[model samples]
Target: MIVFQQRYPVAFTIAACLVCGSAVAQSAIEHHVWQDKRKFEPYSRTAKSITGAIRLSGNPDFATPGSKMTMTFGNGKKVGLTSVGASWRQWDETDDKKATAEAFKLSRDPGHLRNGNTLCGDPQSDPAQYVVFLERSTFGDSTRLLGMAVFGSKEVPHDINSQSLCGTFSYSTD
Candidate 1:
């Protein structure tokens, strides 16, 4: 007959193995978004006011996290060739989470290229930064986002930041 001196160790080992197995079995799916193209006539008075609409889609695998995910812009066409004043917000699924900061700038050159950085609060409430790239397609009348990549930390602070892409943005000059 086999005798067991301690059952607690055996039970703990079994529980640990089950937890680790469940974690290994669960794989995270990549999320994505594509904004519908729209036309924007350059604002005329040093900064012309333009208006347009865009369709935002979430990747099939992930759910749209919230209703308030959006982007906003401030003053533009400043300092000869820079759009200096721009601010955007990316909302999360919960109100307890603060919106991600979308601070970006655009080149005044003919291409009107865009480059910027965004920061989001992590689960630990630390700020994580991401690089953004945007450009207007010369072949088409629409604008395209080249890409955005987040780095510097293994763990993303915000849940929305974990998605392949957080939000699709549409803009107008006002």
Candidate 2:
């Protein structure tokens, strides 16, 4: 899995600057950069663990049954997503079955929202969100949505950020 911080070092900095304003983002960048000159990794805590089905927003073809998506996130402040086209068939049925079962079980929980997690609804409290796009869509050459998930507090963490916030995400295309 591609670690978001390692892959896109400046992505969050730019995004933070755009959403929260240059002052806040710059301050954060400066603080983090000052702390660690090698890289700017913002620390955050796992306030909640939310899991549910997520759609690839505007890309339907990549979200189809035969397509594949693998997501991974860790202490860093971003979600790592890797997608495979529909034609590339080499998926593990066992993993899919487990993920499907978990999704079903979570669906019965009342705490979760109707559409799974409420990351999009509350971005201020938890700013660490992730959106993925297929570099090459199955139907065309342009980038397309793969999927996305969010779960983390914006407040700086006093301890090590080693916990998994949102647990695991699962869904079925059938």
Against the true structure, what is every candidate's RMSD? 16.1, 21.9
Per-model TM against the reference: 0.22, 0.21
- After superposition of all CA atoms, the RMSD between model 1 and the true structure is 16.1
For model 2, how does the per-residue alpha-carbon lDDT over 1-174 read when each residue is reduced to its tens digit? 248767887996687568877555543211110111122111112112343233221222333433322322222222223222222221222122111000000101123343344433444443433222211111353332122222243321111121223322222222
**Which candidate should be chosen as best, given lDDT against the real structure?**
1
Q: What is the lDDT of every predicted structure here?
A: 0.29, 0.27
Q: Which lDDT tens digits does candidate 1 get at residues 1-174?
A: 123325466777787799999988966653223222222233222113221122222113222222112222222212111111212233332223343222222121111212332223231333333222222122254543322222224333233354433232323322
Question: lDDT (0-100) at residue 7 of candidate 1?
Answer: 45
Against the true structure, candidate 2 reaches a TM-score of 0.21
Off by over 4 Å in 2: 1-54, 58-112, 115-117, 120-122, 131-164
